[model samples]
Target: MTERLLAFLILCLVAGAPFGAALMWTGNLILDFVFFYPLFMSGLWTFGGLYYWLHWERFWPWSPDAPPPTLKGTPWISILIPCHNEAEHGADTVLSALNQRYPHVEVIAIDDGSTDDTGAMLDRLADTHARLRVIHLARNQGKAMALRMGALAARSEYLVCIDGDAILHRDAAVYLAAPLVDHPRVGAVTGNPRVRTRSTLIGRVQVGEFSSIVGLIKRTQRVYGQVFTVSGVVAAFRRGALDRVGYWSLDMVTEDIDISWKLQRDHWSIFFEPRALCWILMPETLRGLWKQRLRWAQGGAEVFLKNLPGIRAWRHRRLWPMALEYCVSTIWAFALALSMALWTTGLFVALPGHIQVETLMPPAFTGMALAAACLLQFCISVFIDHRYEHGLFRALYWVIWYPLAYWLIGLLTTLYGFPRVMLRRHRARARWNSPDRGIKAPTS
Candidate 1:
């Protein structure tokens, strides 16, 4: 472990020195990092997003009503919906899974000791619907355990998992399962999740976020031949692959990210299926959004720390890009915190007038360039994703305010989460914490 830490330290210095020197040379270390780093990453992901769209997504038939992919034989699939306190959306979610256009499929709804009517609703649905099965856990096992229970009871080799609040598109199963069925080595296929709650400004901004940021990232990552993580809200897995990886880790805060890394480490391929659309909700308030993002950031940090040692193997070379990018991003988060600290200190202690603090401030030209890059990135993402989501352009107004907000949230979350993960010693069993699911609107 000490050797590994030393090696990681060396790697960071080797990779970060040139950039650090460049920032120091400019005498605007904080401003350059705060402004230029994201701009640089923005350009990278934009290029990748464009390449993915032009070379891949554009050629595919992506009409909302397009037919399911033709397969030699239809395999029986088990759709697992794990719930805690999801009574409000449980029934709708189950029905959406059961309503899939795929012929041979069953729905397994696991009520993970919900304190609400979610379990009863699932039981009622199972009693009436032959295809629906309900599992009642006596205690609140986390989502990973709930899924593990469902997978154990699943009757099919193919498994599709969705959160209890998601409404699966009728043809979603067909798209999600196609890659697993066709490619013998393909182990998992993650679907695209469209934001369903749009009544509030935060909710509406998330709509563009899912498309412009999340969707674009997935597409770009696919182009890179490995994805950082799968969409946990909606994804399909080959039962064999799940078994090979020992299923989801009980201690993993983000099972989806951990499983993605595990599968890839074990030589299993994961695909991103944009056509497999699932309508989901997001946090509609600042407090709720902060809690949600902080958890996500912590989960990501946990996964990174767990996987870095294993990543040294030659066989895991394919995962290098993701690992490197994650490492850099974590460092960037720390850099932002350091910059803020220096700026605060500068305010109290007299510093030379020439030594300007650059936390939130940047030169006009630099700021304009960064803004333009962000706009371009958003435009490209919306253009590529508008086909999958209608009225996407209308959300541009909301999204215009997204980049700055997103950066702040990301910066703060990582700053908090990275240290928490490092200082934390106990690995407790992961538990569920429900977030604000935002107000619901008509599905139509």
Candidate 2:
């Protein structure tokens, strides 16, 4: 609790930085920053995505749905599925991995001390398939530890890790491992995650979120020469790279972000592979969505805080852009939050002359500019990804809610997560509590 208190205190200091400057400068500057940062980021991502498409993605020779060009010799690869109470989706997920079009692949399923029949079911699947192996943990260890064990036991140089509930595309294995096999310096390849839980409005919007926001940002980051993080749900790694970085940090709440930083800091390259598609479920309800996003926000904060000390080095110069962006975004979250609070207080009581209530929102012209930028970004990202996402245009209506959803969600999560991350001590092992994997349709 003391840790939490310190975290809150630190957050107040960080948030207060803008307001403190308001006394020297005008409060208008803070409001302008709050309004313009999102607009600027949207524009950057749109242009970056367009650049990647024109120069890189559009010219790829292989079909998205077919196997990539065959190599001289098919090197062996291992698919790692770490599960925690995933009985309902385990079998189908394993089957998809086993059925990969790539010929030389082995499937390893780790049942991370599931209370349900997850272990028994994995064993049952292993009995029928010679290439499938099952590892049972005596108790619940987190996803990072489970993955660490699986990677250590993997018999191949290339490894693809997916969530227990995700269905890997038939040709995903080859597309993922191809980068590692072809490029000696490439450390990891993050795949495209398509949402399969579209039974609800929230789930439907996330599908577009993956394309417009998640997918676009990755392409942009890769173009910038550093990735913020790999898609944790499905990413392929080079065993040598993992070994060098000491594998995933067991203490991190989000291992993906931590490992991404580790590899990049060590001068290993991470690639974004659009053809390696993985279908996965997402939260269909608001409560579930909030929990999932909260965890993600906390994980991001943890990574930022843990890696804060290393950025001063001259050799880590490439990481400065990403680090500065994170700092600005965190400060922006607090500034926006403060603006809302002051605006609400103004409704009941008058605020000072310098802090006019009208400043709470962008002027009509600025609003239009932001809207135009967001629309361009959405259009470009969705258009580029349309081939990978069938019937994607139909989701355009749902995506209209995306910009607002992301803004509000991003603001709240950062405010709530940053402090907790600041005060928290590292744990011996990060524990896993099963997440909301969305509502699966009934299978007759």
Candidate 3:
């Protein structure tokens, strides 16, 4: 509670900076759009988001679905793990799922035609655990198909899906299943994902990204009764929801986004459970991270393109908000990138072309305001997720790098991905190599 107040205080200070700058009033639209607008939206969204979650129970005290206490004894939950060339990492995930605190839990591990040792690892784990079911596809299929196969093999009504690279918290399954049994129309529960790879700067920064930006936005959207997409790392679903949505899409680049839209279209509500934690590995190199994000951005675009026309329909009104959010975010990314590009090229032309440094950078006042806003957002986010801290505070000095670097990266990804999806004539292929798992040291 004290931390929440501190976050609020920081936001207030950040807000003051912009209004303080407004006293100087240059009347520059570009300056306002590039700097002030982002800062303003950041504070508005962050504060509003925090307010909803912090007092979620009080203001909107009653959820349409009942509380977990009303539910009966232990229910069966199948942990469906889809893998492809994940190797030993797949086994680690299976072990984590089987170790859940929940009673009557089973694991359905699918080896999606991996050329590597992932299949063998699943077999080895299944050999010792009777409840762990292993399904090996003869051919390589997409994640959507692998999940579909695993879902078919699963006997339980409730399903928990985690990436093959993830390690579930001991109580994750138990907490994730609560919404399903407690609520009437709850179809899916998105879990909190923590980064396990902290060996590099990129990895460490992503920890802040997930907790601060991704997690905060999720909580905010959940309060608004809609979410852009569920994190693919760890999510829980009622088997009935999957059935209603016709399962996952084999052609969509991102099965998670595609399926999420499909479920909501069917009138099933999704929930975000922060207590349901799953730690997972992430790409440490720029190249690897770029590939991962591009696939995500592109998948989002594909989904948007498919549903663009339907967004205005009364039946699909819920989708209009998400679609608009994506469009606005995309525009923001491009604008940020263009601003950076002009800065870079202007460096060569600055002194020679007689452009002042003030023109090159955001006005001193606006720059300070933007920086404060970002810091405030990060502080609030990191505070909420401090319990999962991994060198989190120590990594604070590096936080400033995010706004400049990630924005451009997001711009490039969106540019590359959106076109790839739009121009492609063929179906999305099922082929994918193993994701970079960072420089992980082997544990005996």
Candidate 4:
């Protein structure tokens, strides 16, 4: 049934393309009305729907007991926290690591010359926690440099890099380490990160977005061992595998993504464990979110461009295919936005008499289809994330507004990111900014 439906959709697209081309050539109003615009929109929505359907199984977190295979000896794990002006949250992040349920773990907090009381706070935390260690840099080195220093100082077999603002679940460390215990080929494990504070509208919307993204897309990527970005929020890596790639590269803004690609190129398996969760705060305002996404998009483009040669060499290969898939997906969103703009303009300039509303039915139906697609996506989001407070109805509302807002934001970021990528501009400077971790400020 799925294959037949897929084939039918393909035929519709293939047949519609030439019809659209012929209508444009002949300047036939009826054919133009019947074919091009509607088909275009349908194609976009269909692609989205198909993608969601294909990965729908990942919408829920796996059962907790589905543990990674065990190892013979206890492996010492080092937790590296790179802090920059995060005095406000550094202590809490360190404390969270110290509170990990894992028995064989070492907590190392590197204060990247923070101007704030971050260094002092870490000093105090280190004194309190026997397993906690602190490293203070003489100057403000970027996160990549700080991570390198910390990783080098690590005496463990596995190193986990976590942001200063991120708080790991009690079992997160153990879950992260489990993969490496048995899968000798697995170089890294990525944890599912959730937005900690969803008080504001912006925060709530982002919560939904993050849930669907990690729950669906990242999990699908995991199936092929092609997970792209092992988020810096909470990810574990084999020290040897990282050392083999010569440690984290400081040139790019997304060191996480860069390292992931390098690891894949080196034939190292990367796993995404949806059950291994960490909670971190997301940008709470549209402006803040824009800046954050701009940085990410720009960083991604930089990685793509810088590694173009290697990507080309590995075309048709695993990571390369995933990379291309991402690129195409990004481009399609922008294209759909552009096409909508064009269609709206065309609607204003009508060519004369006996206009039939029925002639416009296809485009209208296409719009409805797109809306339904969004609705289905929303359903998935709510189903997966409905465990949190107000999750169901809020997810519905977000689904309604998300596509428009997401594409607009994506378009702006893609436009903003391109030039920066071409000019080699670094927004965050490969450094980590400590988020405000003061006990989630009273929302009321």
- Order by TM-score, highest first: 2, 1, 3, 4
Ranking by lDDT: 2, 1, 3, 4
Query: What is the Cα-based lDDT of residue 39 in candidate 3?
Result: 76
The residue pairs in collision within model 1 are none
Tens digits of per-residue lDDT for model 1, 177-270: 8899899999999999998888889998888788878887888888888999999999999999999989999998899999999999999988
Per-residue accuracy of model 3 over 54-138 as CA lDDT, tens digit each: 7762343222132322235678889999998888677778888998756689999989989989888889889999999999999
Candidates in order have lDDT scores of 0.85, 0.87, 0.75, 0.68
Model 1 has an lDDT value of 0.85
Clashing pairs in 3: none
Q: Alpha carbon lDDT of residue 412, candidate 4?
A: 79
Judge candidate 4 against the unseen true structure and give its global Cα lDDT, from 0 to 1: 0.68
The alpha-carbon deviation from the true structure for residue 103 of candidate 1, after best TM-score superposition, in angstroms, is: 1.1
TM-score for each candidate, following the candidate numbering = 0.93, 0.95, 0.84, 0.78
Give the number of the best model, judged by lDDT. 2
Worst 10 residues of 1 by lDDT: 14-23
Q: Is candidate 1 or candidate 2 better by lDDT?
A: 2
For model 1 the TM-score comes to 0.93
Candidate 4, residue 360: how far the Cα is off, in Å = 13
- Residue 357's lDDT within candidate 2 is 42
